[model samples]
Target: MSATGHDYAITRTLDAPVEKVWAAWTDTESYGRWASAEEVVLDVRPGGAWSSVMVIPGGARIPLTGSYTEVVPNERLVMGMNVPGRDEPVLMALDLTPDGDRTKITLSQTFDRAEDRDQSEQGSNMLLDGLTRFLAAA
Candidate 1:
């Protein structure tokens, strides 16, 4: 939870080393391998921009764009992302912790409206689950 009234968090564990998990996030090519099936164009530096088009199960493509707010090598990442046509962009933070052979990943997203926050919470959790599976296979 954030100081802002509209925020949500999701924590997940990956049965992989922290460095390997981090690479799945920081490496643009690796990120694309799991972030979406279509393609992911990521410039993963502070202030760098990133975008992805996810080919959903029904074959619909949903595009998302964001700018990196912070990029801490293997520890964390924060970004401000917006879905086109949406009113407010969300602030998303990904925190990683190493625990022996496993890694704990926490994802937090804050929105401006309560409704949006709720929706994002559910959606992000699904995405995180997908990420977890992706990393495990990598």
Candidate 2:
């Protein structure tokens, strides 16, 4: 959680070029290679929709869907996450920066409640780790 206490943020640098990183994000097949999802459908544009079916521990597939609020090619993406049972949508932003040959990415999600932010932090970090591994092997 941030000092303001409503956001969960994670930053990671992948040993890959900005173009490659951006391709991996914008391509559904490339995204599925990293994200812990059984299936993924993404349309990367403002007002476009994206969804994934996550493969959880119990073998149950959890559906996560979102709409693209902002998309700036290789630099930034802002998405509104639609979690089941939540009346309010959670907002997430990804900022990508070129760091030499590597790409640094900062991903942050905002929730209405601090408890929700705290609870999602670990999982967010774990997903970033997964992305690093996926990029390394790609």
Candidate 3:
């Protein structure tokens, strides 16, 4: 998919079929494995709720809550994430497209400030890296 004027966009190609990639993304058990979350609760449907306690570096646990604004099975997912101390929720869109035997994934996040976009890039990359490893193992 093309850019959607999101503040931050990260693209990755996973060495897995579109079906496997989509399952890893939408399934709470698979997602928690890739995300390294302490806990995860995902209701994968439009208007559903999702939350995760991410265990970042130094053993710090960051709680993130979000609601799904859109869900289109293996094609697309849009969620609004509520992070602590943030006045507005960050909107994130996950798009998946099949590329032969593999899958191309785009993660686009919309933030209100440029600093927020810049600050999130590293963490996003780390998450993608984790996902790649997770898929490789699977």
Could you give the C-alpha RMSD of every candidate to the true structure, in order shown? 2.1, 1.9, 2.8
The 10-residue segment of model 2 with minimum total lDDT is 1-10
- In model 1, the runs with Cα more than 4 Å from the true position are 1-3, 85-88
The per-residue C-alpha lDDT of model 1 at residue 116 equals 84
- Scored by lDDT, the top model is 3
Candidate 2 Cα errors over 4 Å, as ranges: 1-5
lDDT of 2 by residue, 1-138 (tens): 455558866888889988888888789988887877867999999999999997766798888998999999889999888978988567788889999999999989877687888767776777788788888998
* Candidate 3 lDDT tens digits, 22-84: 899888899999998967999989889999998987999989898999998889989889878
Backbone clash pairs in model 2 (N, Cα, C under 3 Å; residues 3+ apart or in different chains), count: 0
Candidate 2 vs 3: which has more TM-score: 3
lDDT of each residue in 9-77, candidate 1, tens digit only: 788788998899888877777776666645687788998988888776578888878889899977899
lDDT of 1 at 82: 79
TM-score of each: 0.86, 0.89, 0.90
Give every collision pair in model 2. Answer: none
List of clashing residue pairs for candidate 3: none
Q: Candidate 3 regions off by >4 Å?
A: 1-6, 85-87
